[model samples]
Target: MKIKKILNNSAVVVKDRDGEKIVMGEGIGFQKRKNDPVNQAKIDKVFVMKDPSEHQKFEEILQLLPEEHIQVAEEIITYAEKEFGVMINEHIHVAFSDHLSFAIERLTNGISIKNALLDQIKILYVKEFEIGLWAKELIKEKLGVEIPEDEVGNIAMHMHTARMNAGNMQETIDITTTIQEITSIIENSLKINIVEDTMSYERLIIHLRFSVKSLLSNEKNHDYDEKMVNMIKENYKEAFACAQEVGHFFEEKYRIKYPEAELMYISMHIQRFYGRVIMS
Candidate 1:
């Protein structure tokens, strides 16, 4: 592919079949100009974003970061994708690169930023947090900078933010807190520690996130199978009761009115969680 513009000796913008992308390597863009062929042997990585606005942001951020730091960050992301088996959005390459730069800056200045949701993240996003730990280790190994432990949580948040593609940072934290609250209520009712790594809990959190987002957006839940819901409510009275309490919590806080169908589904989900805890 021909280079469209050079960012530095190591990086350049290239127009390829996939539209525009940032290509980087040891000396990929050295002595390069618009329409110059990209050197395949020297190529380290390419970053592309589907959103033009985000792509612009990526380019702007990439220019601000040191080539070495960007290279290491790229390696961390590559590890995360392989470790998690999730195709993280290219937006992360930019968003996380910016975040890491700032985080490293804070550490160098003897300033530290604490992630408020550190504990919540550990409990709710076990896999991501574990990957965050790995990311932190890589940062240390590559950058030779020992950041504070709290930074690992921030790294995990990046992964979480990448996966959900939620709102801004605050909104993402708020979503996490809401999901945690819902899970806590169910856990307290059942008096069991949630095995968050399980598929059942995975389903529960997905449903809860959708429910909370709908509540905040003032969207209504559609009616489901009335017969099945009734059967669930009658047969799973304990779980239904717990779900009713959760519904009340949201209603009081967000003024969301949950339909009976919604409540039944929540109860069924809770029942599944309860069953798992018991069986385990």
Candidate 2:
């Protein structure tokens, strides 16, 4: 490998034997300066930039990002690569990278994009909270660390939020809100109720999942498709059935109505959260 360009002390652009390919890394060109030989051991990963112009444009965008933003973007990229197995080069598409940068920026600025999406985020958040609680219990049982509940919840919230949003705030919020509003109407009209301690989470999860599926299937034609309206209505029927199951679950377990407010709150969360899954 040979040095193509030095992006920064910790990063650089390089070319392989095939020639003119762009590779990114932290220490690829550490010892050697510009126009110097690069050791193969130091090379991290090589990528064929199909469009040199696109690569240049991407580089320009990165240059405009603040150092803190860059750091966050790196963290997101690293996480996606390590956990989700997304190649670094492919992960840096304009939409994906831009969304990641914006999300991190919002987090740093103390803006809860979660609230913006309303209900979707809320349901996912509850699931996140539950997962956190479960993780904490497992940690205590296995390692005896007794992790703080708040810390677990916070970490889980961030993880789930990041996953659902694909590191994009606005998109996540939009999808979430749409699901929330639609589900809320179904719950209200059907007169189903749920409780926090008794089957509410399960019910909310079912409704949210179905609602999101419905919305995504017709999201593009949301405004014009009469068929979409029909699909939404059918989805509502399924959601209502989930709600009824919750009511039944609660009635059988604790002999109570469990209040409709719990489902309503979950609806709020679903309505506000956004983002789509990136299929591999």
Candidate 3:
């Protein structure tokens, strides 16, 4: 690979037979000119961005954010990929780097934003949250900045979206928010507190997560016959009602038509949750 453009002292754009790539390493770009042969041993990370805009955006990010911050974010991204045993969406490089940079900047200035759904993120996205905690430690070790646990939750959100290839950070936030809202609706409508860590709560969360994804992607669920739907509605009135409330909320919030099959499944889950809560 040869340098096409120098991004900074540690980073540069290179072109090979494969295509254009952003290469980073310690002092790799220092004192280097365009078309310079890249030192293979010095390369630490190489990002092959398929999209032109994404590639350009990352180049801009490297030019602006501190190299240390970018390096730390890259470390976290690498760790996440290895831990999950798969390649994550490439956008995480840009998104997480930008987010981590902003977070470090804010913390330096003594401004903090609490993650309101921190508890939910921990309970719902266990692996991602664990990775986020590891990322927090890595950031502190490398950058000498102690970010709050709320920031850990935010990091977990980024990891979750990247792993799922679920669009962007905002979409992850929307999905998590929808799950919480559905949980609240179930609790309020069924008049029972769904305890975390319990089988029912975990099942409900998983169900809601997939349900939200399906709704967002406009995927159809297996529809029940009218009689079966009526039987469920009649047999589990309160649970069915709670499911309806969730469907209504989804429709209003996401501007997407909520599927009846999803509502039925949600109702069944609610009924099971309520029964478990009542027994406990």
Candidate 4:
């Protein structure tokens, strides 16, 4: 291999044996003086070939990118390969590359992807969000900085996308909308003027979490074995019971029947949750 153009001490564009333009960086091959024969042993990563004609374009743009941006790009590529089995070459699209880089930046900055429903869903989904959270934490620990939490949902969505084929983008949007409805029901039904110190609201939130996660996971995976299906039903029953108990608590505490709108909301939530889990 020979350097076709050097962007900086840390990055270069090189030509492979097939005469394809390969993006090479400092950590990729053995360290050597300029013009020395490139050592294959030190190569840290390789990127997919953009059209050969774009080599000049790449070189020109690369020169203008900040060193930090380039460094973060390299780090994202490395982490994707090591953890997520994503090939660097496979992510040549500008959007994918940028997304991965931003995710890394957030992770390095100590930002956690906080889902308000995370605690609630632990029992039903076994904390699938934890996988994304843990990945972020690992990056922070390794890079010695906190990752921002703003894009946690994007990361989780991408991870979910990788796990299953949920059809087209439209289908995914519809499914997600349905899931939100169910969660909203549980949230509304739990609203009661109970003593501030009571744990009823807390327990209700936990149940809602499980219901939402089960719905999401089931939709994403598109598979539910007999045992898993049974588990979901049991969870829904428990969640419904919890909702009813909260309603009763409210009626007794407030000296009025829980409004019919609340029951309608609860029914919608349960139905939508179950529909998503079963049909999606």
Instruction: Compare the candidates by lDDT and give the number of the best one.
Output: 3
- Model 2, 1-280: lDDT tens per residue? 6677765444556666666755545555457687787666655545565777866765655455543344344444455455544343443543444644564455446654333333344455665555556655654554334544444544344445455325444444444554455445545644443333334444655555654444344433223345543454354444434445544554454354433443333333332221111111
| Candidate lDDT (C-alpha), each | 0.79, 0.48, 0.88, 0.46
lDDT of 1 by residue, 1-280 (tens): 8998888788889998878888888988777788998889998777776789987887777677887777777888888888777778777888888888888878978898767556567765677788888877888888888976688888877887776354555666787787888888988887978776777777887777777777677786576898898798788888999989888887887676767777888898888877666677
Tens digits of per-residue lDDT, candidate 4, 21-54, equal 5455565433544445555665555554556544
Which portions of model 1 show Cα errors greater than 4 Å? 16-18, 164-171, 179-249, 258-280
Model 1 steric clash total:
0
For every candidate in turn, the CA RMSD to the true structure comes to 5.6, 13.1, 2.7, 11.4
TM-score: the better of candidates 2 and 3: 3
Ranking of models by TM-score: 3, 1, 2, 4
**Poorest 10 consecutive residues of model 2 by lDDT?**
271-280
Residue 279 Cα positional deviation in candidate 3, in Å, after optimal superposition: 6.5
| Cα RMSD for predicted model 4 | 11.4
Q: Please state the error at residue 87 of candidate 3 in Å.
A: 2.3
TM-score each candidate. 0.68, 0.48, 0.86, 0.45
What C-alpha lDDT, on a 0 to 100 scale, does residue 126 get in candidate 2?
65
Best by TM-score: 3
- After superposition, the stretches of candidate 2 with alpha carbons farther than 4 Å from their true spots are 17-19, 27-34, 49-54, 66-72, 85-114, 122-174, 186-198, 211-280
Error of 1 at 193 (Å): 15
Better of 2 and 4 by TM-score: 2
Ranking by lDDT: 3, 1, 2, 4
